[model samples]
Target: MDKAKHFERSQDTAHDQACDPGRRALLTRAAAMSAASAMLGAGGWTALPAWAADTAKPAAAGEAAVRQGVWRDQKRLRDVPWRLRLPAGEKPVALVVFSHGLGGSLDGGTEWAQAWADAGIATLHLQHAGSDRAIWSGGLAAVKAAASAEQLIDRGHDVQFAVEQLLQLQKSGDAAWARVRPDALGMSGHSFGAQTTLAVAGRDFQMRSAPDLSESRFKAFAAFSPSAGHFPGGIKGITRPMLCLTGSLDGNPLGQERDGRYRRAVYDTLPAGAKALLWLEGADHMTFGGGGERGAGFGQRLLGRERDGAPEKLAAHHAAVIKTITTDWWRWRLLEDEGAIARLKAPKGLNADDEWLQG
Candidate 1:
């Protein structure tokens, strides 16, 4: 099937869901609250079981522990949902907080999270309600509206609030939170979430909506499919290390920037410090967004698969390269592993067409 045709049919299916009264009633209220909460300030904490997961296992050599929960801020009436993935063992490890793109949920970065966990790093995937998969229950208009500037600002606050909650949880002796090294932290995102990552990194994108939404806690950053054209000021306020991942075919779905090369502006404009760019030959936008063993989620379904007809081996190859490079990044930057730095400089796994640069 043609990619455009498949995406149109998927959008039609999504629009059809808007007609379901029950689904409409539930998600509408939640999305509305998410928008409202973005404007309000912070508040108290309320905990709720967000999802069902496998048994919480101790950190073994090859396994990771998964836990899910919703952390609510009463003052803003914002319900921030999250999923935590920890490496095997009880030792403290570096933590990376992941933000999903528009129409994505906490389940968005499953592949990346699992890889990071298996590599002995902890990950927390955050879902911004107003812009998450909930908006899909509405329609194309709703999805577009959910990506407003207001939600972008709200997402930064959500990251800050979530980190605050994590700190409190650590102080209170939560097992998973306790294993995270607060001093060693990183931030990452995909697409719109990439914009959020930049926001948290102190790139206000020349917007004054929220005086300064930058949080100084994150030590390093990574952005997948980051739009360098969207924001004018390039790497002005971001002094921390950043890794940018984009593919030759990673075009913008919203038509803001048609060519994938435009995405390279993110790496191009950097001021030359601890920054790196990984340009894959055939990977598409959805390729960087999850889709592990469990398969594609809303991102892949909405944007079409990166490996629609290409060789299946190529998809596996891309996945392997991504996981290896990203895990090495977290280790080198967050864990201060010297050997990881060497691997990052040369980057062992890459096809002839793939390019990896470091400065």
Candidate 2:
């Protein structure tokens, strides 16, 4: 079958599942059973396995439950929502905080967070006030009001605030976060959010310091389709490992410089050993979730249509490769999962033909 036909079939299947109550219930029950089995298998319901567990369990509690919560960063005051997903237990695992690109929200990073969460890692997805994609669709006035340079600065501060808030939550007896070790933190962002992560890591990009770094914390960083225009200066000071993921055709006139040159400049300048860059061929800025035909603007605009290749299929392939590689990178760097690094640095041919590691 043609790629379009396959996509349509997948969408139809998903729609049917959503509309069919019986299937939904059955799926939910199956998921619950799987979770229970994983917990109880051989180990007798021990709170996660030792490799995955963060802290020692108390006899009274039996095993700690992975906790999920949502809270606002008062320091941001932009009313953006941030969601936290932590493993169920008292053992604090390394934390991975995600920021969204321009016009993206907490929901934008939710799938990525969920992917990591399912892998036994914790994630925090932050929704930037005024700067998410909603502003773009809301009209030019809204976009101008939210996507300003000042707003970007505020957004960067929001990232710092999120880190501080997570640390505070850990200290304040938040059951869902009791096992979170604030010291073991990694930051990631997509597009402008990727720039924000750089700013929080003290990379000398276009962003200004919030003077709250003493309280804010992170150990490593990853960025996807980072906006080069906001390249904060002084990135050389960042000693932590960094990863940059971009597509050959990601340049969008609106935010990221249309020419891949800017991203190339930034990625090339970063110090070598601790940094890696992945380039996906035939992918544009919108390749992640929203650009495909099945996305919000399917009929209105050809978000993922490519002349040389099947855009939708290529985009899906890129997103999957990114999710897999990134999760492995985080596992290796943050959780000290030695086995994950090899998988991350493995040749792209193993997953997708279009994937390439660039210098």
For every candidate in turn, the CA RMSD to the true structure comes to 8.0, 16.5
Per-residue lDDT tens digits of candidate 1, residues 1-359?
A: 43222212211111111111222332444466557656653343343333223245455566888777777766456788888888888899999999888788877678988889888999988988888877777765677666555566568779988888777777777677888888999999887778788778876343222235588989999887776543335355577888998887676554433345877777887768878899888777767777631112343455553434432436787788889999999998898999898898788879899999987
lDDT of 2 by residue, 73-104 (tens): 32222354666666545566887887776556
lDDT of each: 0.70, 0.55
Q: Which ten residues in a row have the lowest lDDT in candidate 2?
A: 10-19
Best prediction by TM-score: 1
Q: Which one is best on lDDT? A: 1
Candidate 2 contains a number of clashing pairs equal to 20
Model 1, 156: alpha-carbon shift in Å? 0.6
State how far residue 123 of model 1 sits from its true place (Å). 0.5
Model 2 TM-score is: 0.68
